[model samples]
Target: MSYSVESVAYWYLSKEEMSPKKLQKILYYAYSWFLTLQNESSDELENKLFEENFEAWVHGPVINSVYDQYRHYGYKEIDKFEGDLPKFDSEALDVMEQVWEVYGGYSGNELENITHQESPWLNARKGYQPLDRCRNEIEDKDIFECYIQRVN
Candidate 1:
């Protein structure tokens, strides 16, 4: 089913209750990947790479990473692995609202910083750094996993 961006974000950021360290580590890897791309590629190239690599990573190792970690921590039936998500068109707006509440309405720069911190690969793309752009697609995948746990 189709899920709104907000529902997806809420699921990822607010729904699941990951340990601070685990969450930080995950974000770190994502950010590092984004940064690596940013430092090495042009804007258009970086965007393409981020999009391609993110899709691969999300469906491949990244999903496994979350699953392994959650399973190790005794969390079963994680949504990322299960491919379950909310069905809503306004998901992005909801996610933005939640982000505003949690992050206190970050400026574009602040959002960029956060995106870089969370997924450096996507951040590497100069004009494509907004968390709401293609970057959100990858993050939302992760958030969906988190949301599943949080809602349950």
Candidate 2:
């Protein structure tokens, strides 16, 4: 059955299936990807941006973000997921579907737009031209592929 972000967070924090070290790495990588996307804004920087944002987009957001986004959609509390961070699995994938819709297919532009309106992290990069430039790079490659991989 499909799982929600709250369930995944509970699993990660409460269960003993995955290693703490592994979970930490995943979290770190995922956060790093968000930072990279936040920083990059040019298409010319695709390779560099990918290198910097790789883990964040590939694993971090694909999994963690999905859970976070989904849990929120289901009207679940953020504290619950934040309380735990390792129990993610296929159920998190269900949440990811919801995230994609919320994100408008994970378009960097959409992320930027929403980030401007809500997310503090993206707010820092506000009016940063390079951030806009890199939108296409992420859309053409990372966003589409990541969504397909996660759902499949």
Candidate 3:
């Protein structure tokens, strides 16, 4: 049951008030963890949750489509969600919950700061200036490796 990035973002928003910047960072973290968990369990890649491509943007990893959806909120909390939440299976829900538990406590800027210190975002932003706007997609493999390293 693959979810659209918006659906996943909406799920997160439904759980708490989050800024667009925080939402983007959390979405990237959730996606990265999903890939890592699925691979570790020997699940097929097709069973992975979301397919949204996270680009290494100036603020860290971002899904442009999700960003456009929530951009109106600016740096403010998204108080309301208009979309229906998707029916996520137990495994998906479990993973999402864990992702939230591990990364949800941080502020948007903190999440961005954490990503900046991680290899996946750093590698993607390689050769780019600190504030340069980049569209380089953070590869799923890199995401998995980075998170798995921390988990082990």
Candidate 4:
């Protein structure tokens, strides 16, 4: 089943308290790994998981809508999520769980630092300043390549 970025973000928030910055980066990683995990086994699955691409912000890749929703909290950990919780099939849940298990342990700033060094974020932020608001979308192909390469 497909899930919205907000839905994924809410799921993560439900499990842990984190700043919006961390939520955005975690969603990006989850989306990336969801694609890499499936590989080419199902194009439909990729489309379902990635309804939209993330923009390269100074902090990291972000779903602008999701960011806007929780921006009021500033750099504080989000205390509550008001959106509907997303329901997924067992397979999708497994991927989400694995994503949290691996990346969830890091602090938001750490995730941001890691993304800054990664190709997908760096490539999209090419020519952008540290505080620039970049609309450049981090390509899924690049995300897939970067994560898949690390796994191999």
Best by lDDT: 3
Model 4 global lDDT (CA atoms, 0 to 1): 0.81
TM-scores of all candidate predictions against the true structure: 0.24, 0.24, 0.91, 0.88
Residue-level error in angstroms, candidate 2, position 20: 30
What is candidate 2's local distance difference test score? 0.32
lDDT of 1 at 99: 40
List the candidate numbers ranked by TM-score, top first.
3, 4, 1, 2
Ranked candidates, highest lDDT first: 3, 4, 1, 2
How high is the CA lDDT of each candidate model?
0.35, 0.32, 0.85, 0.81
For residues 70-144, write the lDDT of model 1, one tens digit per residue.
555442223332335555334334443444355443332343344454433342343542332332224433423
Candidate 4 regions with alpha-carbon error over 4 angstroms: 41-45, 80-84
- Model 2 Cα RMSD, Å? 14.6
What are the clashing pairs of model 2? Answer: 3-91, 11-87, 12-86, 12-87, 33-56, 41-130, 41-131, 41-134, 42-134
lDDT per residue (tens digit) for residues 1-152 in model 2? 22343343344334232322233333323333332333333233242112322112221223344434444334222232334344444434333333333432333333434333322223233454633322211232433333233333
Q: Report the C-alpha lDDT of model 4 over 70-122, residue by residue, as the tens digit.
A: 89999888985656786877766888899899999998899999999999999
lDDT of 3 by residue, 20-105 (tens): 89899888888888888778632345556787788999999998888887788888899856667888888889999999999899
Residue 104, candidate 4: Cα error in Å is 1.0
Candidate 2 clashes: the total is 9
Report lDDT (Cα) of residue 105, candidate 1: 35
Q: Model 3: residues >4 Å from true position, as ranges?
A: 40-45, 82-84
Model 3 misses residue 63 by how many Å? Answer: 0.4
